[model samples]
Target: MTAIPAVTLNNGVTIPQLGLGVFQIPDAETRAAVTTALEAGYRSIDTAAVYGNETGVGRALAASGLPRDELFVTTKLWITDLGRRAARDALRASLDRLGLDRVDLYLIHWPAPATDAYLDAWQGLEDLYAEGLARAIGVSNFLPEHLDRVVALGGTVPAVNQIELHPALQNRETAAAAAARGIATEAWSPLAQGAVLTEAPIVAAARAHGVTPAQVVLRWHLQQGRIVIPKSVTPARIAANLDVFGFDLTAAELTAIDALDRAGRTGPHPATFQG
Candidate 1:
């Protein structure tokens, strides 16, 4: 098994650079998918309250018999649960479903800026961190302005900022903002949800490296110093995604992929997304 490198967060906690993401996996099927990843050497699992699959994740964790300290579990607070009190309760509920006392990481699922409640949510996360309910806290889909406000609160800075990033949508602005704040950038929808798998640049790189296009793209992300959680239910892909450490993309190859960005965003823009 290839040893996946860990990215040390600003707070000194370590997170696996490559992990399994259960974004759309239904509750009934998430356990098997997670189990497959764990068997293939994945220790990090990203889930959210909106996904409604934490119980399934709990089942897989229980069956794996992996020590609690060895696994990195992450869950999020939804927009409806953005206030300080609501955020705490939501995580408690998530922990109940996950069958764990503390999550490795917890995040505010979305900024929902219109509601202007994320600051309260961040405060809640700060309290949770102090209470030892979450080892680390972060925000997802937050733009630069949103990050600034969180930082201005003078509380715990976010350990990670997860955003929709891929060859088609680099999201460099937000990524840069996160970098400036000493926050690790985690790329979700890293393959553009398969939209970039067949691009000429990726295909050429795949052929040159004798790897799949998906592998080539994942390598593109890893080489750029970003955390990626590519989701796949196929057993072979689950194993192959972790095999990216065996290859490296050349500078020119990386640049070619970088040029493929077209501002193609599959999800709602964080600035105006109410939820």
Candidate 2:
């Protein structure tokens, strides 16, 4: 098994650069998928309260018999669960469902700037971190402006900012903003939902390296220093996503992939997504 490199967050907690994402995966299949990834040497698993699969993920963790400290589990607070008290209760509920004492990272799933409650939600996360209920806390799908508000408030700096990122939607501005603040940028759709696999540059790079386009894209992300969570229920692909450690993309190859960025995002824009 390839050793997945770990990215150290702003809070000094380390997370596996590559992990399994349980987005859009049905509850019935989540456990099996998580089990397969664990058996393939994956130590990180990213899910969210809205995914409706935390119970399944918890079951797999229990069955794997892997020591608690060996896994990096992350989940997010939904938009509806904003505000200080609601956020705290939401995390407790999430913890109960995951059957874990603490999550490796907890995040405000979305800023929901329209509601103007993310800042309060952030405070709740700080309390969780301070209490050790969460090893680290951060936000997801947050734009630069949203992050600016949290930073100015001067609590805990977000350890990570996960967003809809892929080769086609590189999101350089958001990534750079997070990097400037020492927040690690995590790519949620690192493969562009299978849209980038057949791109001419990706295919050529894969052919040159004797690997699949998926691996090529994942390698591109790793080479760029971005943490990527590529979701897959297929056992082979789950294992293959973790196999990106062996290859390195050349500078030109990396640039070619970067050129594929159309500024096209597959998910909702954080600035306007109130839900």
Candidate 3:
């Protein structure tokens, strides 16, 4: 089993630097994918209600036979679940599906700024944290302004801000803002949906290190202090993704990759996305 490094959250909770993400994975395939990842030494699993596969994830966890403390699971509340009562109910439903009493981290799936209820949604998360239903609460796809608003609203500073990030979309400003407020930046599309693997910089770096382009990219995220979740259902790829802790990227290689950033984003814009 690879000894994946852990990053400490704002509230003293720690998360594995690398995890398996079940985004876009079919419900029938999620269990096998998660099981492959766990057997490959992955201790963290990121899922959400929107993914519609939490039930499969729960089954995998139960079958893995890994102790609760040995695994880190994360799930999110959808935009419709904003506000105190709705948020709590949504989390309970998610817990029931996940077959867990609590999650390591829970996040607002999106700012959904158009609805103007993120503040209320965050407050609900705060209540959950207080009630010990969630060890750490945070937001996802939030821009700097949205994060600032949450901080000003007062409660717990988000333990993390999960967003679409990769070499093509560096998202430096959002990351900087989160850093200033002691929030960890987690990369959702860390590989750019396999769009970056063939880029010259990544390919060259992979060649130089005798590793795969995907490994190089994952290493880049780790070197930059960003937690990354790369999703894959293929057994070989799932194991390959977790094998990134073996090498380090040189400063110049990191810079070359950084220069590949074109401010391109594969997901919805947080500033305008309603759900």
Tell me the number of clashing residue pairs for each predicted model.
0, 0, 0
Ranking by lDDT: 1, 3, 2
The segments of candidate 2 whose C-alpha lies over 4 angstroms from its true place after superposition are: none
lDDT of each residue in 113-214, candidate 1, tens digit only: 987799999999999999999999999999999999999998799999999999999999999999999999999999999999999999999999999999
TM-score of 3: 0.99
Off by over 4 Å in 3: none
Clashing pairs in 1: none
Q: Which tens-of-lDDT digit does each residue in 1-275 have in candidate 3?
A: 89999999999999999999999999899999999999999999999999999999999999999999999999999988988788999999999999999999999999888766889989999999999999999999999999999999877999999999999999999999999999999999999999899999899999998999999999999998999999999999999999998889999999999999997889888888876
Q: Positional deviation of 94 in candidate 3, in angstroms? A: 0.3
Q: What's every prediction's RMSD, in angstroms?
A: 0.6, 0.7, 0.7
Error of 3 at 226 (Å): 0.7
lDDT of 3: 0.94
145 Cα displacement, candidate 1 (Å): 0.4
Winner on lDDT (1 vs 2)? 1
